[model samples]
Target: MILRFSQLIVGLILFGAGCAVMVDAGIGLDPWTVLAEGISKNTGIGIGWVVSITGFLVLLLWIPLRQKPGVGTVANILVVGAAMQFTLPLVSTPDHWIARVAMFIAGTALVGVASGIYIGARLGPGPRDGLMTGIHQRWGWPIWAGRLGVEATVLVTGWLLGGTVGLGTVLFAVLIGPMVHVSLPVFDGRARRRRHTTPAAAVGGLSAPGT
Candidate 1:
């Protein structure tokens, strides 16, 4: 339980931090966020609205994919949107181009960290990602194909909506995969330690209830 809770915290932190940094960077942002920012800019809707609408619609798509929603899925939808709405403004870069670039890099890197932790938490995936895997499973598509299809669609829609797709988008696509690859292991080690300290039931070899 402790391990799971820690993982949840780590995951949320990473995800939230990523959103914050990507926005403040003032360059292009992550793809999904790229879409949200685009909608916000053109529609004059709040960032949260854009995020929530996308997340909710993604989950709606997931239902047809046979992906049952869980706590992580629920949290995934709202948490980032809320965090983005709240934190993006709080995270800002200085006037210098170098400073803006630094913020962008840091924000993107933090996204990698967040992706790793949240995934390692073994919690449900974020709504968009969940939709990707769910469609792959339900439609008998390859993981790569499914992911690409979803992302491509989102990217286009977001662009049409007015999201900026620039260096930030490209950098994120290349870097985050490797970042998650590296960081999740450190968090997995922490989870393993917490599990070892947790007592299990002697009779059935299961964890105690509420544990």
Candidate 2:
């Protein structure tokens, strides 16, 4: 329990810091971050604050979807943006385009790893993730369709609202799914345990709910 909680907190903090890195890169951002950035640009709010506020607002939408929040979900709302806020002021954009691209890639990779770690803790889905799943569960829409529709809306809206749209955004879109796919299994604690446990163990007396 202690280990899972620690992993969850650390992963969320890293995820926020990774976002700060990408923002400081100033090339382009993921769809959600682009939305946050666009709002921040227009409202003069810090991007991190926008992220937290947006998260809370998104969580409210869960009521209609009948989604239940978990410890990790609540922590995600509280911790990620604060960590980003703390980290952003410390990072500055690079002078060269190459360096900026590299920073964005690094940040994206960090976020991928962080996603695995926090999600592997098996506490709960983040609000945005839950929203996607809920859409599928309630309406029987495919997950990909729900994700694509929502993300495309956010991406286009954010672009219209003055968020950066460039190669980095394209790169993120192309790479993130694969990145998460690779990272998820590595950090998935339950899966890890399952892999290590023998078939004999499963049939012999150790069977339980998650097994």
lDDT of candidate model 1 versus the reference: 0.76
Model 1 spans > 4 angstroms off: 189-211
TM-scores, in order shown?
0.83, 0.92
List ranges where model 2 is wrong by over 4 Å: 197-201, 204-211
Winning model by lDDT: 2
In candidate 1, what are the lDDT values of residues 151-180, reduced to their tens digit?
788788888878878887887888778888
Ten-residue region with minimum lDDT total, candidate 2: 202-211
* Residue-level lDDT tens digits of model 2 in 32-95: 9999999999999998999999999999989998999999999999999999999999999999
- Could you tell me how far off, in angstroms, the CA of residue 87 lies in candidate 2 after the best superposition? 0.8
